[model samples]
Target chain A: MTSLPALPTPKKLGLVIDLDVCVGCHACVVNCKEWNTGGYGAALSDQDPYGADVSGAWLNRIHTFEVVPQGGEIVGEAGEARIVHFPKSCLHCEDAPCVTVCPTGASYKRADDGIVLVDEDMCIGCGLCAWACPYGAREMDLAAGVMKKCTLCIDRIYNETIAEIDRQPACVRTCPANARHFGDLADPSSAVSIMVAERGGMDLMPEQGTRPVNKYLPPRARKPLASSTPLPKEDTTGATGFFAWLDDMLDRI
Target chain B: MHPAPSIIIFTTLSGLGYGLAVVLGLGLLDPATLATKIAHVLAIAMIGAGLMSSTLHLGNPQRAWRALSQWRSSWLSREGVMSIVTFVPLLWSAWVCVIESRYLALPGLAGSVLSLATVFCTAMIYTSLKSVQAWHTPLTPACYLLFAAAGGLVVASLFAFAGGGNASLLAVLAAVALMAAWIAKTAWRRNMLTLVPISTPETATGLGAIGKVRLFERPHVMENYLTHEMGFKIARKHAAKLWGIAVVLGGAVPVVALLVLAIVGQVSSAIAAMFACVALLSHIIGMLTERWLFFAEARHAVMNYYNG
Candidate 1:
């Protein structure tokens, strides 16, 4: 059934991304593609590998933007323009349009974990599910002939054989900056939930009504340094002798 | 959004075919006539050909039948079911016209409603998509139904003229429908032009509190699937020229030809038939152009993130 099932105690297992430290390294994007391709659905296909058009079915991507600060006139040319690295993936929305719009019953949101997945066997590759997504999370695999998306590393997340510390999503586990967080957002007491509350994590495109489970913590407000210029030309070489002597006396004591 | 030829062909041909089915099912032209029988066959053939063309772009066309099982929530699935269901009555009506040489009211009326329903389902497939805000409107379905009706009337009148029947009334109706479809479509174009973008780069990235978000760099150096498929951009000036051409060819030429045929139809059957042919062909070419723009110009909300 394409209609979402009503589940009691459905755990919204999702990610909380911290934008402050994301550095736009694209490690998460690469790790996600590497893990998801070899694991769930079919291998994510690439159209061209070494050629000019090297497009592929990547599950995650990083987009860089220059913000002109709320009321600023200049765009990216301004000195104070803030740069943000946005890592995007499927948010595993509660009301996932991609799941409901599938002509085949291939796309479904898991009632047990709130993870959206595509059953490759039934996918017609009609590309309607990709179109329905407001976040551009889904991609049509050229070779596999199936829709590929972020499975939230379902195969790794629930695996028992792997060590507990390594059981998280490859993107989160492999993140060098600790930008990505994976936990049950449904539980208020979970670390991810508390972080979201404290840091004021927000949904990307909240107006779209996808009700995305994953939240993005906004970049910390940046302030200019108090003194960027040289202080009073500092009386040549070591002119403040009294303060220097006081520092030496304290060191001796 | 790629303006793919396969889809443009599918939507255009299916609309015209189903539109033809609409009038034929109502017994507009006599069922006993050879021309009417040919028209019936043409209608079914176009619908079949159109449905076939739609599967050309699918990666897993062999698994296309799986699409029929999920009509409960999917408009695309409903369209699949309706297209097949419509064939039953259409084939029956066509068989009766060819063999028995008469129109069956039960199947005829039922086929008409089903054909219209099929068009509605097809339109809803695009209209239901909230991701493409331009298409997420009642106007999508309204334009589809009007165009289908217009195309059907225009074709049905051609058969009416060929058969040497009372075609004047049919010609006038076809002309009016053609005019109305274009008028509604003009309004649709205006709506797209003056749209208040629901999602912007600022809102998409949740950076509105900070500043105007401008794309500094895309994730990939080359175009990815999202960029390739949804990044189709037509300049404003180019789009305006095409819109004017579409209106002139699809609306002005066909409507004028059809109106002229309504007057001189009975007096000069040969000349009227030529005029009807002009109306039919021009209307089709015009609709093809309009349908191409329908896909090309409409921006998807997901593109807000890409800012392409």
Candidate 2:
């Protein structure tokens, strides 16, 4: 059961995250924890809640980074600062290391949709699977004594009970900026695939050879560190007689 | 990368246990002697205790039996199977030596081969994990094998001396194995200190195309499982001190004691045996320190994100 499927999954269902639009709000992370706690195998447990040392297992995580161009100041002294929000979850890689390292066959990747999952019933909580993963996606539910990870909302994505519009993964639906996109990545015609192509989506640590299904759209290029052009002057031509008088008085002041 | 006491005990005691078992399997000492019989029993007991210690760290030890089912893909599973399979020949050899009062060549050699193989399987569990850059290498298995052989030779020499067998040659061989293990460990430590990280913040977030990325904020304000488990670090000064101690106790002291026992010409078995016992004790404690350092200094790939 730990061996990867002989044939590639045709669907390759995954997420495409647009870094240009993510607001660092962590809404996707919160909603992911909210939905997965109730929908998946085990409830994500938090230890020492409301205490000085609070810890828990969460399926989704967002890291914020400040990008500074070479030779540019780290702080926004010249307005060159760029902050990027990075949201990460299970990439459901084609050759997931987590699946192959599981001694108990608890961690596996579905051949149909390519979603990596943990069968809680079979997990021995040895934590070898967690050590194998490069993305830090899997978490062990201490209360349940089993590994937990992003199922891509297996309960909701294909459910017939929910409304069609409500059936998408909770994180994607909850993203306020619509930075998260979901679809079958194997199909060129799929919306997510098209977006990836247009945006030149990239993999996280491609050198690790995980071949992650999830792709991240890099943040768009920012303005030069020191712009050669001057700031534009205010347009005074459209001011009416009263507005013009007020503008002229303000300019004089 | 936390140096959990359970794991340290498991690797150290198991390596010594299996090492002693491997030496006994070669029929190096007289099977009729009481010391040889005690040595065989000690090996089995050490292996058993070490295995039980490993299970103590598991969250669900009750379900650990299922871990043996996936040997086709998992090194951990392979280790489980190999360790269990190894017991058949080991027990058989033990029976032949104690109950029958003779060394059975077939079972003894087979058990020796299997015991070393089990140690190799144990090494593979760490070496196969690419996420821990320091552990993923050929040198890992080499270190484990050399140390096991060295530990086995040291203990076997003691039994040989007590059984009035060829103790001098075994003692010299123990010194050589100790040197080999320490030399290999030095190389491994050097490799760990000098390894250039392939994955960095630039590659992790993919925002490096624009510029150098620095972690401004973490997803959770509180300590999460990833941080708690993978974010262990050891002070450079502390690590250096421990390395020095491990070398003295595990390498220099044991090798010198074994060599002295050999040069003393076994004039007094009582004094020589006492020295051998001290050497074995030093080697165990030294190897325990080395194993603790193994876990403490190892930096996991996830630490790249945590800045640990």
Candidate 3:
């Protein structure tokens, strides 16, 4: 039952995140939890919400990293260090090991749209799917005794009642900086696909060979800052004393 | 990977059980004997206890029967199916041996093959995981098979000594199996230590082009399922100490004990039986520790995202 689709899907609907504009505001993270908690996978339980060690199951998470360009100066008037805001969720991989490792057929990928999902009803909470995931995309809901993961907001994206413009993942709609884009990656002409092509989007851990559908656009290169005023040239003309030379230079300036 | 006690106990006890079943199925011990009957009963008990303990770790133990449906694709499911299927022949063989007081050749052979196959399936459950480099190796199954054989032989030796039949041969077999298990385990540990992680922070983020990357801040201030499940870390010194203990108790002590049985078994059958029991007990404890380390030491590929 956990076997993969015999044929690949035609439409690989996924996400393309732009790291350049992400401000690490965590709007995506917060909104994902909010929507998912009340939405399809309801009540993403938090253990000890007010206690010392707070832990819970969250589908989307953001990680901030400090990436310094190689052989670049440590400190400069122009920005030399880049702080990247990485928002991570399920990529709905074409070769998702998570889906294949499920013992009860709870985890699976849709052949029509290529959206990976978990069927809570069938899940026995063995947690093998989570272990098989290289992206850390799956989370086990201990209270519910089932695994939770990003479903790409299947309820909203395909819902006829929702407005067309709003028919996207909650995280994408909630991103304050408009850093997340959702569309069909299989179509070359799709907006998200075009953006990926233009921005040189890349897969995380290509060696793992999960073939993640989500792509991350690297941060843009920084432009050097131009100084407003040029320094005055030093006048080292014949001056007998230091004080006299300073006075003459000051007068000339 | 947290070393959950349920799984550790399941694998260890079940491995021992299946190993004993395989030995019994091979007609290594006399079928029309009280010692063989005791061994058969012990095997069934160990397997039943192990299978039951495995469900303790499941979130819905009542729904565990559903796990057998995916045997065509999942190793875990195959293990479940195989274990259940193996029990039929195993129980039949035991019944014939204990009740009829004779070995049923066909049923005994079938049970033996199925028992070993079930153990292979158990090993495949971990070996098939691509995300865990430490366990995704040929050595994993080899080690499992060897340890099971070694543990089974030691138990069989004890029964044989108690029954006053071929104690020296069983003891020698146990000794050889123990030595092989130890060598294979040592190799597995060495391989795991030397294996360069295919996944790293740079690869995980796909920003290796940006030079060295370090996490400045995490997504949340609190821990989450990913962190809790995959973030298990064991100190190097503690792991080394456990490794030493496991080798000494599980491998060396059993080997020495079995060797003593082989030498003094004819002269002092009572003393040899006692030594055999000691080896069995020590090996069980040692395997438990080894299984704990097995889980503790494995670094899941998902952990690279958390800088684990």
DockQ, prediction 1: 0.76
Q: Every model's Cα RMSD, please? A: 3.9, 2.5, 4.0
Per-residue lDDT of candidate 3, residues B7-86 (tens digit): 99999999999989988988989888899998998998999999999998787677788899888888999999999999
lDDT of each: 0.89, 0.88, 0.88
Error of 1 at B22 (Å): 0.6
lDDT agreement of model 2 with the native: 0.88
After superposition, candidate 2 runs with Cα above 4 Å error: A76-78, A228-253
Q: Each model's number of backbone clashes?
A: 1, 0, 0
lDDT of 1 by residue, A93-156 (tens): 9989999999999999988889989999999899999999989999999897889988888998
Specify the CAPRI tier of model 3: medium
Model 3: lDDT of residue A114: 93
lDDT of 3 by residue, A92-130 (tens): 998998888788888889989999998888889889898
DockQ of each: 0.76, 0.81, 0.68
Which predicted model would earn the best lDDT? 1
- Cα lDDT tens digits for candidate 1, B49-75: 999999999989999999999999999
TM-score of chain A, model number 3 = 0.86
What's model 1's lDDT at A134? 88
Ranking by DockQ: 2, 1, 3
lDDT of 2 at A169: 91
Docking class of 2: high
